[model samples]
Structures are given as structure tokens and as C-alpha cells.
Target: MRLVIARCSVDYAGRLSAHLPLATRLLMVKGDGSLLIHSDGGSYKPLNWMSPPCTLEVGVPDDDAREAGVDAVWTVTHKKTADRLTVSIHEVLHDSEHELGVDPGLQKDGVESHLQKLLAEQIERLGDGYRLVRREYMTAIGPVDILATDADGASVAVELKRRGDIDGVEQLTRYLELMNRDPLLAPVQGVFAAQEIKPQARTLAEDRGIRCVVLDYDDMRGVDSGVPTLF
Candidate 1:
């Protein structure tokens, strides 16, 4: 990971155009070939970022840019989308790189962890021929809760959440996008499974062609849910 604090201006070009006027910001270039520009103050979210599967080129500024006080320029281009994020540096305050090895990934809390385990055990709950590929399937960004295959043998990525919300859907979307890029998983599908799903999240998931599943925790564990059900 490389971190640089510099005075720079940023421009994003592609589906949309955006610009960040000259200012001092933190520029992060991760080992995965992604770049993120962040201001000192803001939510954890970066002011702007280029997702992985991208390339970065560093070059000296043009004559015009040099005359305008620009020192260097960094161009980041997305391999798939062709979107470009360009940063024109005026001055560098700090720069450093660190070699952080493989991450162990996030640890799920007890309930969420158990939910994943139960779902993996009852893989058929997804459908007639659904089979578990693996739990905590590692991806570039993070581990997908579960990776499975459906009746047709197509890849299915399941994201388990205690309560499904927009964020969970978004996370699953990212995983699906990345997975679909693989030739072996070209047509990967997504399932957002949770004990309860928010209406907004359900709508978003469906709009993206992802399926949603509500897991009955007790039933999966062979324990009574205590809610009356018609036999």
C-alpha cells in the first residue's frame, strides 16, 4: 500500500465527469491497483476512488500544467469500464509505502457466524439442486459469505446478513461484479440472505436481478421457531 499526502486536483472522466479543485488530500494506492483520494475530514468513505482491476501511470506534468504549478500527474484507468481518474499533483507533503501481507478477513459475530454455518449445512435451502461451493470464499476485496452452484451449475454468490440492508446488497453487488469477470464464473448470480430484509434493499436487489432469501434460524438448526405454521 502506498500513501501520499499532497496538494492536488482530481478529475474523473467516463460515464460522468467530476472534479475536485486543488487541495491537500490523502492519496491511497492499494496493492490491488486501486486508487482512492481522501480529504482529511469526511466519513470513512474516500472522496473519490477507482476500484480494482485498474492501472496507474505516473508521468511528469505537461508544459501547460507545469507552468500552472503542477508537479506530477497520476492517471488511473479502469481495465473493464475505461473510466479514468487523474490526479495532478502540485506538491507532495508525505509519501510512504507499506507491505501489508494477506488479511485474515473480518470475523462475523456469533449469530451471523452461526447463520452462515447453518445455511452452508442446508445448502439445498436455496433451491432443489443448490450445492455449497464453500463458505468464506476469498475474493480480491474480501471474503464472500458463501459461494455455491445452482441446479444449472452456474455460480451463485451468497451474502449472509443478520438483517439485510442497502449496504449488504451493495457489498454483494460488488462481489458479483468481480466474480462475473472470471471466465469460469462469467454468469454468476447473487443471493442476499438474511433473517430480515429491508424493503428498500429488497427492491434494490431485485432491480439488479439478485435474489433474496429470508432464513429461519431456528428451523435451520432443527429447533422450533415457535411461530405457528400450517403443516
Candidate 2:
């Protein structure tokens, strides 16, 4: 009834003997608190590979399984202490809760960094122009989350939000206008990358050729596109 990870046997045709994805791999924890070693193929050897089949208790028994006038039984049991396997996945990136630190302002900075990391992962996979500009870009408006570019190599100023809000559209619009009209900055598209996207803001973005992306944390694990869109 307990779990452990060790060299176990399995029938060649058993379900667990099939190949599995590497991402699904996790450290196997055992009942005795020891870890199991993974095979060269990145799989655990099957429980019945080299061991005898699991014994079963059936309705009738043969002479070898009987005693006196009563029918004998054969029940499955582990041959050794290290036969169970349990897996646990480790997070590759820090969670938001880990952002708090000794310095209050640094805590805010940490939160931003975590959010940026999530966004960066998405941008990398979706393709280019996502750069983490400093908070120094914040004017009377708000902090700029990114300066993203679109497929056409057009720059796009971005504003990031931990969660979607009404102000994101307005803030991004102001930045977009500034960046598009000002000669100092490129005439770019606009986008707001956040955990969620408001319907109204999405409509507005489409109307202005601004790209608003709802960057779910689950989708940000890879690289990006080269275009930077402005929001």
C-alpha cells in the first residue's frame, strides 16, 4: 500500500513499458524514502520485466495451493521493499509568492521580474521584438511592460499587467500615440500583455491595429518571434 522506487520487473508488453514523454518525467519517491534510478531510455524498468507474474487469489485452487480440505490462495505482494514509484514535478520558474523580499521596493521589482519572465517566455515562442524596458519609461501614465515588434518589423510599445484591468487600454493608447507620433521612438503598434484581456480593450486594440495578447502563464515556457508590436 506504500510507494517506493527501485528496479522492478514488468512484462515486455505491459502498459508501463511503453515510451513516455520526457516532460512528464519526475523524481520517483519510494516508501523507504529513497529515489529510483531512471533507465538509460529515461524509463523505469517494468515491475514484471524480470520478476514472476503477480499471484492472484482465485475461487478454486490446485494441490500446490491447497491445504487440508480448504482451498489455498495466491495473492500479489512485493518481493522486495523497493518496488513502488511515485513521481513529483518541480517548477522550473519561481512563483509569484516568492517575489517578496527584505526590501519593500525590491519586492515590487521582484514581482515585475516574475511577470516579465512569464511574458518573455511567450514572446520568445510567438516571435520577436519583446524587450523589457525599465520602469524609467513610466511617465505620468504608467510603467511600460515591453516594447514589442510585429511581423512587419514595426515596433510596438507594450504595457504589462499582472491581471487585466480597464486602465490598461487607456495607458497603452497613450503610450502608443506617443511612440507612433514622436520621431525619437518608432511608429509602432500597441499591445497589452496580461494574465487576461478585457473584451472592450481587445476591440479597441483590433480597431487600432494594436495587438493585445493574453499571455497565460502556461503558454510562456518557450522562445519567441522577432517582431515587436506596440500597445
Off by over 4 Å in 1: 115-161, 164-231
* Candidate that scores best on lDDT: 1
List the pairs of residues colliding in candidate 1. Answer: none
lDDT, candidate 2, 1-231, per-residue tens:
122222222112233433223232222333333333244463556222223322222234455424323232212323353232222222222112122335445345324466676665456533554444433265455556666555666666767776656667777888777666667567766666776777887887677676666665533544444457594
lDDT of 1 at 192: 98
* lDDT of candidate 1 over 1-231, digit per residue (tens): 999999999999999999999999999999998999999889798999999899999999989999999999999999999999999999999999999999999886437889999999999999999999999999899999999999999999999999999999999999999999999887999999999999999999999999999998878888876889789
Model 1 clash tally? 0
- Residue 231's lDDT in candidate 1: 93
Per-residue lDDT, model 1, residue 51, is 98
